[model samples]
Target chain A: MARVDRSLVTHLPLFAGVKPDDLEEILREARSARYPKNSAIFEQGADAQSFFLLLHGHVRAAKTTPTGEQIVVRYVAPGETFGLATAIGLAHYPATATAVDDSIVLIWPTAAWPRLAERFPSLAANTLQTVGARLQESHTRILEMSTQQVEQRVAHALLRLAKQSGKKLDQGIEIDFPISRQDIAQMTGTTLHTVSRILSGWESQGLVESGRQRIILREPHRIVVLAERSADSGAA
Target chain B: MARVDRSLVTHLPLFAGVKPDDLEEILREARSARYPKNSAIFEQGADAQSFFLLLHGHVRAAKTTPTGEQIVVRYVAPGETFGLATAIGLAHYPATATAVDDSIVLIWPTAAWPRLAERFPSLAANTLQTVGARLQESHTRILEMSTQQVEQRVAHALLRLAKQSGKKLDQGIEIDFPISRQDIAQMTGTTLHTVSRILSGWESQGLVESGRQRIILREPHRIVVLAERSADSGAA
Candidate 1:
């Protein structure tokens, strides 16, 4: 067991309304661990015996098809929870999570969830809210994929990334992590070639800058305009 | 206020592990209401002041595109809850829900959710589990849409519907509700013409029976076969 940090409880969304003493009691059962970039935190279909809270770095949640195609579902940032399927009674992890960078995370055993939930009703409520929010975001992504063109989807994805983890650079707001064109393609439900072409076009038009595994938004509003533009224009 | 049913609490998945007395106490704050077929129970983006539990008949949860195309997201059956978005702190409904047939539902004010959740930890945990399950399903659908061909998508959609609310008929397993070809189109991300043609082909092969507004699966395994078949066959 790791020493419980009173401030860490305040940082986690699930423990928002819980008192520091209550969180300390809960965290007595938790341990802090670190993983290097590209390390598999957990594998798909593995028994979900634990849940995690990221304290630093990024993680990617993904699923793999039988044909070996990988689809990136979500990216977890610091202060967010992962392995939530366990909280919901799932026996196995639905997707594989890999550390995107050197990451520090707080780990909680599955056995502790029910006890903590019983003790602090607010924790349970907050967990439900977190799941609900994620579901809504997933639904929005589904609607976009079903209706929006590829370029539009890419633009929207970039905006979402900006909102979550953007860092202002000399030129514009840059997504503060390493992300390849292929990663964007997977997230946007498009082919890598399509993502590359559209990004190159945007780069030429001064809408964004793309380089070795990074994207910087030169004009965020312009990207929004492109995303909201009618598909009839054939720009997609 | 209608007399609340003590038995109703047992039927709700959210109240699965709750004590009978506690459940009855929660139910005292609920009201039973009925809606005629095709009546809107709630609209997307409406103030989500309450949550509902279906007791009889069926409800369809759907979202409409700005272009006026309606997509059926899911169907709520007896004992299932809708409008849970509000319970999880959403300010408005993310999707509209309507009665597919004359339906009876239990309505609980949003304010009651936190109270009930606090008093019965099981209810909160179950709600979170439901949200998690939906998120997994949505992710699976996204994977299907991105990688699977149209025919596979259709087959998968049918399987999902059957799992949710299929009824055994002389012909096969009927979907247990009315759904237009257009609804199938929206669910499968295809056109009505394409859905019609595919169903017609399936009907000819005795894989399914299609009526004016219902689909009966004659051989569900065949649908599974279609869903699993390689896209290289060009059956789509």
Candidate 2:
């Protein structure tokens, strides 16, 4: 197990009220594990055994259907927690957590939860806040997917990703992580062919530029308008 | 304020292990309020100042787009909590909470959360569990919306609602509340015209019987099969 920086624990919302000694104790029992790009940190239906705190890199949370279809639920940023199936009493994970890039995570056995929550009440409180916000966001996305057209849904997905992990570039802003059309298709709940067609249309308009899974958003404002334009669409 | 049965507090997942004095204090401060049929209990973008526990009747949580189109997020049931905007630090409510029928709720100011959590850690833990489950369900719905066909999505929505609040009758299982085709359309992210067309087809097939805000599943198993079937459809 690799030791974590003491300062890192002090800054995390989940550890807001955790004392120095308790934090040290937790770090002592925790394991810092690394994963290569495109590998799964945890797979759906696997044993839900641990909770992870991302130390570095991005991960995509996805769920798959019986028909072998997939959808990206959300992406994880550094300092965020993931793989929390046990928090809701699930015996197995309901989704897969795959590393988008080479990543590091601090792992703790599920057994640590009860002691930790009782010792630091803020831990449970912070967890409630995080889960509540994610629930709200998921609900918002459902409404968006239900009411918005494919074009609007794709634009909104890219915009959300850009806001979370965008990097400034000369062309405009890049998504920062290596993601493909298939990944975008999964995120927006459309086929890769459709995403390709939409991206091609946007490329001709100088709105975006893409090559080999790397994309740069040349114009975000126009995309925002496209995301909100709903009159002619047959969506609810 | 209308007083609640003490047994109700004793059985709630959120109140487990709370001391009798603390439970009594919380109940004493809580107000049981009634909402008339079709009236909004809380509207979107309003102040996020209160938390509610549904005591009786149903509610529809929905969000609207800038174009004035709306979609239902989820239906709230009795013995559940809603109006949790402040639970995640949002200053304004992100969605509207309207009574589907006349309803009653136990209302508590948001200020009570911290004190309640401090006195009863289980309160926060239970909140975490509730939020976590809702988050998981929302993620599942997003995946279904992204990867499933309109028929499949609609089927799944009704099945979920029925499972949550269905009442058995001689002909079939009736959804235990009033809900419209427009509401189902909103939940599934389709137009009412499409919903009507599909429901008409199903009615002919004896799969469902719906009219005037009432619906009974004549053949739930067939709908489940339809929901789980995925090929040859415009979905992920």
Candidate 3:
């Protein structure tokens, strides 16, 4: 582990009000770890000993069903936190976090969480906002999955991924990392065949382009309209 | 509007760490508000002026689509909180909170949230758990909605409602409050027609009995199996 850049802590909105000395003291017990692409950072049901501050790259936090199917709960982007069982006051990791690419994250022991939170009230305050926003987003997605058709769900998922992990490209907007049809399916709660078919239709309409593992959205606005599709619009 | 029973705040795990003086000071600005059956405590898109602690009775926190269709996001039971836009750092209520039955709640100005939070950091820490748990539940629902059939979804919704507000009756576990089939439809993201058809089928099987805005689950275990159904199992 290299000497961790402490700026990562101070710069975060969660710690913006934190003093330099306080952040340095907090970072003293923290260490940085890296995981290669497609590697598990932590497995589900393991003792949740720590929480993380993502410094580089991407990761997916997922849960597995009894029958061995995995559901992607969220995508961890840079500067965000992941593996939050401790922050949420849980004893074990409820989901597995896997790196989507080679990634780095600052690790803090679960024991330190309370002390840090008590010492810096904003830690808890800002974390509440983060967790609250996630809850809101999750609720919205559930509504979409339940009310909206497959095409709308897929469109909404892609647009969100683009917002979080998308990189602007000359052609349009590109989802910054390698994501498979299976990954999209897992994220949207659809089958790979269904996702593949949807993507194929989008491609023919010049809405998106896909390669082996990359997807580029040519007109994200159109995708938004697609996502906002009303129940009656489909019948029309 | 009456002086809040301070014990309600202290007894809660969310405020376990706060001093009595602090709790009283925080509650000084709080008041109790009541809503009649089916009346809204707060409406979606309205300025988020306050959040609440459910004291008695049942409530439904829902969001309405642009087309005036409502989606039930949560059923607010006693001891839980709702209309938490301020806790999430939002300016307006993202959803509407309405009394499912005649209900009472302790309401506090959203503006006071940050001040009290800084005074008692546990407010944020405890809220993280609440919001995180919600996020986890929403993720599970998204997965279910994506993968499960409509029958499965309806079964799941019933089982959940039973868990939240069920009352033991001579016949079976009666949903304590009056919830219309349309409410079930919104919760499950199905249509009233579909819900009606399924409930009728269950009635014939003696698994459930429905009477306008009321339902009893005679066989909850079978409903659990229905909720756990797999794609292949149905075909088989």
Candidate 4:
């Protein structure tokens, strides 16, 4: 693998506060790879041999239940880290990571982790902060699933996606990636038919615009109101 | 406050691999406090001024929804860490932590994290691993909520609690903590009535023994079979 330029990653939060020399050493140990759209980056239960940083495009992390059902755990955006099973003491990947779009990522063998973390204390600190943020996000979703209504849960999911990867447009903020109603269903713990019905209802109310593999929040404020509204009949 | 003895925490996972002198220094920065059972350790959205380690007793971390419903996030067992809001970059506690039993905790102000983490690299690595493990657990729960039946979810929750804090008895493993049906309801994202009905059915079938504020799994193998049973009419 060719050496990556320091300029490519000095701006990343993972590299923040790391000296240029340390960053050079870290970058040298990484090899870059690309996945075509919809290609699997890694599979659940496979040996987690490497950690990754998405340098370009988006990735989806989905967990397959024991019963053969898949749940959309979360999405990974550019400059975010994933496939950190070894860092968390797990020997196998807990979820399968797939490229939602043609994507590039920097890969480092898990064997290099201890050395890298020891040499660059900031790296561990940064990763800790990142993991912390994601834990909070997961907790937020759990709360939404447990206490909020289905429509509210869907609204929250869209809002979170928009916040994470939205592209501001005239209509509002487009999700900026190809996402289907099935993805939203798995995200919010609802069935696809129920998500479709809720989206259709929102479309009629001018709250959102949905199309094949696309979603745009036309009235984000209104959606927020719905998301925060008190429980109706409860989870769908 | 009197200084806590070093021996009190030498066996904790958080202190693993930390040198004795370093442990002493870390202990010097912490003050111990006791929380009476059923008392609030910290409220949601309060300034996250400190991080904590449970020295003795259990703590329940619950998130209260906007509509006033409380969801039990998880239970904290002795020797576990909690209140790490600042470590994750949060300015306030995300959930309210309450002592389920009279508890003693070692507290350290958030201001000490950076210096301590930098000086003791193991601290950062340990915390990263801790948060990573929790992030995986949260994802597991999310998967259960999205894909599993209510009975399965409850079974998983019980199994988890038992693993975390169970004591062996003549009949079966008893969850060592005082967990009520309502707590189980909050943990499994089901109504109290639903949890009660399921437990009653299990009791008659010799799967578990339930009582006020206590439960025992008399037939864990059968419950595991139920938990792994595929899609019972899809997520009650």
The TM-score between candidate 2 and the true structure equals 0.94
Q: lDDT tens digits, residues B1-236, model 2?
A: 66677786677877776777777887987888899889998889999889899988999898987778898878999889988877776778888999988998999998877887766777777777888888888888888788767888889999999999998888889998899889999988888888889899899989999999999999999888888776474422
Docking class of 4: high
Model 3, docking class: medium
In candidate 3, residue B207 scores what lDDT?
A: 91
DockQ-superior candidate, 1 or 4: 4
Query: Model 4 segments beyond 4 Å from truth?
Result: A233-236, B233-236
Against the native complex, each candidate's DockQ, computed on alpha carbons, is: 0.72, 0.75, 0.69, 0.82
Residue range A1-236, candidate 2, lDDT tens digits:
56788786678887777778878887887888899999989999999889899988999988988768788888998889988887766778889999988999999888887777766777777877787778878877887777677898899989988998899888788998898999999888889999999999999988999988888999988888788887484422
| Tens digits of lDDT, candidate 1, B194-215 | 9999899999989999989899
Please state the error at residue A56 of candidate 4 in Å: 0.9
lDDT ranking, high to low:
4, 1, 3, 2
Question: Could you give candidate 4's per-residue lDDT for residues B111-229 as a string of tens digits?
Answer: 99889988998888888889999999999999889888799899999999988988888899899878888999999898999999999989988899879888999988888888887
Comparing 1 with 4 on lDDT, the higher-scoring candidate is 4
**What overall lDDT, based on C-alpha atoms, would model 4 receive against the true structure?**
0.90
Q: Residue A230 lDDT in model 2?
A: 70
For residues A1-236, could you state the per-residue lDDT of candidate 1 as single tens digits?
A: 55956675576677888888888787888999999998999999999889999988999999888877778899998889999777888989999999988998999988888888888998888888888888888888888887788989999999999989899888999998888988888898888999999999999999998898899999999999988886887653
TM-score of chain B of 2: 0.94
Looking at model 1, what is the TM-score of chain A?
0.96
Off by over 4 Å in 3: A229-236, B6-10, B229-236
